[model samples]
Target: QGKNKKVIILCSVLAVVVLAVVAYMIFKPEEKLAVSTVEVTKQTINETLDTTGTVSTASEQSFTLMNKVKVKTVNVKEGDVVKAGDVLATFDVSSLETALNEKENNYEKALAAYNKAKNSSSSASGKISSTKKQIAELEKEIETLKAKTSTTKPSSTKSDSGVKVSDDLVKRFIKIAKRFGVEYDEATARRVLTSILSAGSSTSDISGLLDNLGTIAGGSGSFDMSAFAQMSGGSSALINAEMSLVQLKAQLATLELQSNDTYLSVYKTVYENAQSEYQKALTQTNEMKKGWIASEKGLVSEVNIKVGETVETQTVVDGKDVDISSIISSISSGIDVSKMISSFFGSDKVGIKVLNYPLVADISLSKYDVLDVSVNQEVSVKSANNEIHEGRVSYVGAVATSTGSSLDLNSIMSGGGSSSTIPAQVTIEDGDKSFIVGTDVDISIITDTQENALVVPVEAIIIDGSDVYVYAYNKDKSTAVKKKVTLGISNDTYYQVLSGVSEGDVLIKNTSGLEDGAKVKLK
Candidate 1:
C-alpha cells in the first residue's frame, strides 16, 4: 500500500514540472539571431576567358662565315643599330684581286682580239684578199706582155687576144668587182679583168661574170664587144702587141692605187675595233666593283671577321675548260631554311640573348577559343607577382598547335581527350623591361558582358547537391524562406541570376547555419 502511494506521488510531480516548462516557453519566444541581408538588384556582370602565356622575343638574327674563310675587316660592334646593306664584316680579297688583275689584262687582250676578228666580217677580209691578188696579177700581166713583145711580131688591135679588153670582158669585169662591194670604174674594170686572167680566174667566176654583165647590157647570150671599144680608151693600138702592153701598164696603175688605199683602210678599221673593245671591258670592270650591297634595314649587332686573313680558292682556267666554284657568299647565305623562324619552322635562336621592354607574350588558346580572338583585341595580363598589364592582341594564328607543356582547363577537373591549341601574340603597354622573356603569366580575355542583370551577392547563392538556392525574407519579416535561382555569369563579387529569382526579393547575404525553409531574422 505504501509503495503504490510513492509511485503515484512521483508521477504527479513529473506532470507539474512538464507543465511549468511548457508555460515558460509559451510565454517567452527564442530571440531571432541577428544576421545581415541584401536586397536583389540589377547590376552588370563580365564573362571572361582566362589563360596564360610566356614572354618571348619578337625577332632575331645570326652571322657566320661561308667556309674556311679569312676575315678582312670587322665593321660593326655589338649593340649597334645598322641599316640594311651596312657592312658588318669583310673577307681578305687582295690575293684574289691581284690574281684577277693579272688575268684581266690577258682577258681584255683576248676579248679585243675576238671582237676584232668578229667585227671584220668575212666579206671585208675577202674583199681585201681579192684586191691583193688582183694587184699581183696586174703586175705579172705587164711582165708577160713585155716578154711576148720582145719575142713575137707586132700586130694590130684586132690581132691582140691574150688580154681581154673588149666590150664583153669589160662588162664582165665591172660586174665581178662591183658584186663584191669594191668601188670600180671602166679603167678599174679593165685593169681587174686583165689581172684576173693573169692570176687564172676560175671558169665558174668567168661564166657568172658574163651572165650578170649580159643582164646589165640588156642582152642574155653575151655582151657586145665592139660597142664598148675604148668608151674611156686612152690610146688606139699602133700594133696589137703594143695595144696589149699599153693596156697592161694602165691596169697595173689602178690596182696599185687600190692596194695602197682600200686595203690599208680595212686594216686600220680592224685595229681601231680591237682598241675599242678593250676600252669597253675596262669600263665595265670599273662599274662592277662599286663594293658590297645591303639586303635589309636593321641594327648591326655582330661583326665576325678582321683584316689580313688568307683563304684558299679554286682558279678558273678557260683554256683547260675547268668549272671552278665561287668563293664569295651571298647575303641569303645568312638567311635561309636553316636560320629561318615562323609557324612553318618552329623558332630561331635569338642573336641577342636578352630582350625586354614593350614585352610580347606568346599565348596559346584552344582552337575554339582562338576563333573569337582577333588582331588588336584588348587584353589584361596578370603576372606571377600579381602585376596587371594592359595590352592589345597582336596576332591570332589560323592553324592549331601540337601537344605541349600547358595544362588544359578540362584536365584540371575531369579527364579529357588529346587537345590542340592556336597561338596568339599580345603586346603589353609600358612593359619597360620589367617582364622577362620565356616566363609564364596569367591572362584574361573579356569575351562577354551582361548589363542590368538581376544579381545577388555570390555568398547568397547556396548549392544543395545539383540545385542552387537563395534564402529570402518572408512577407511578415519574421522568418527566411528558400528561393531557388538559375545563374548566368559571375564576376569576383556577384552572381548574375538568370531565373528563379526576382530583382526585388530580399536575400540573405550571410548564410551561416542557414538551410532551405529555415527560420531567420534580418539584422
Candidate 2:
C-alpha cells in the first residue's frame, strides 16, 4: 500500500509538467517577416548617358580651282598637317601670266575705245553748232542784198501812175499779192523792196520777204527781169542773195539728221560692251594668280590632283558631272579669315580647300535619352586604347537621321537596340591628330545633375501603373507603410527623390515581395 501511494504522486507531477509545456507552445505570439531597409540620404546624383561614336572633321574646306590650270607642285598630301600661310600647291602660272597680259591689253583697248567715243560725241556737238552759225551768216548776207536792191530802186521816192506808195502801203500790197500768186509790175517790185528796206527787218524775216518777191515774175504779163533788177541793186546782187538762201536750207537739213543721235549711240554701246568684257577677264586672271595656300591651320583631308594634273572647279559624282564652284565659294564665304595672313609666295593667296582645325566626335542618342542632351553640355570621350578626352556637346540633330541607324553606346553597353538613336556632335577640346578619323570611340554625356538631394536606390522604388511609390519602414511600429514618391532625374543606381520622402527616412530596400502595412524586422 505504501509503494502504490509514492508511485501515484510521481505520475501526477509528470502529467502537470507536460501539460504546462503544451500550453506555452500553443499560446506563443507569431514573429514578423524580416526585411532589409535603407535610410533616405542627401547625396549628389549625376545623371549621365554613355555611348560610342566616331571622330570626324568638324568643318572641312575643300580646295577647288575656279579655272582649269596645270599643277606645278603639290607641297602637301592627304593627312598632312598645315598652318596658316602654308603653301598647299603651286600652279604652272605660265598660263596665268599669259592670261593676265591678255586681260591687261583688253582692258586698255576698252578704255581707249570708251574715250574715243566720248570725244566723237563732243565733236558731233561742235559740228552741229558750227553748221547753225553758217546758216545764220548766209541768211544775213541775203538780207544785205535786199537792202542794196531797195536803195537802187528807180521808184524809191515816188509811186508809179500817181498812186501813193507809203512805206507801210507798199509792204501790205506785196504780202497780199504774193499769197494769191498775182503778177506785179516793175514799179510795184521797186516799191516793195523800198518798204522792206525801210522797215529794217531781221535776217530771219528777210528770207520770207524775198520769197514773196516771186510774185513779180508769176504771170504771163510783161514784167521784164532787167527792169526789176534795175529797180533793185542789179541782176548780179539778186543772184548772189538767192544762191546764199539755197546753201542755208541745205545746211539746216544736215543739222536735223545729226540730231537723231543714232550714230553716236552705236559708238557708246560698243564702248560699254568692251568695258564689261575687260572686267570679266581681269577678275579671272587675278584669281588664277593666287594658286593654292592654306587659309587656316588644319589637316589636309584630301589631295585630288597630281603634280601635272589640270584641275577645274568641277567634279564627277555617280558618273554625272556637277559644278561645285558655287558650292565651294559658299563654303569659303563662311570662314573667319581674320586670323590668317593675307598673302603667301609674294602674292595674295587662297586655297581650293580650307579645313578649320580641332577634332569632333559624332555620336547618337536614342529616344530614351535624347531629351536629356543639348548643346554645350559636358561630355567625356574614350578611345579604344582607353585614352579619355574632355569635350562638350556642339550640335544636336534637330531631325531624325535618314538611315534610321546609329551606334548608340548606351544601348550597346547595356545590350539594347539602337534603332531609335539620333545624331549628335561633340567637340573634343584637346583632340589632336593622334585620333584617326572615322574610328569608333566611347562617349559619355553629363545630361543632368543634382546636389544635396534626397535619394534612394532604384530597386527600392515600386512602380504601380503610372504611380511610383516606396515602402517606408516605421521604426516605432516596426512595420512598412506604402508611401508614394515624386522622382526627379535618375542615374544608374539611384533616383533623385523630389517629394514624399525626406532625408533620414527609412525605406524597405527590397520590396520584391513585401506587402503594405506588413510587420517587419530591421536588417
lDDT of 1 by residue, 455-483 (tens): 88888889879899988877585677887
lDDT tens digits, residue span 326-433, model 2: 222223366422211111101222344545666888886766678989999998888656888889999998777543455555557887554455788998886756
RMSD of each: 20.7, 21.3
Off by over 4 Å in 2: 1-35, 59-358, 365-372, 385-389, 398-400, 404-422, 430-436
Among all windows of 10 consecutive residues in model 1, the one with the lowest summed lDDT is 320-329
Best prediction by TM-score: 1
Clashing pairs in 2: 51-409, 52-409, 62-352, 62-353, 63-352, 63-353, 64-352, 149-233
Please give each candidate's TM-score.
0.42, 0.39
Whole-model lDDT values for every prediction: 0.54, 0.62
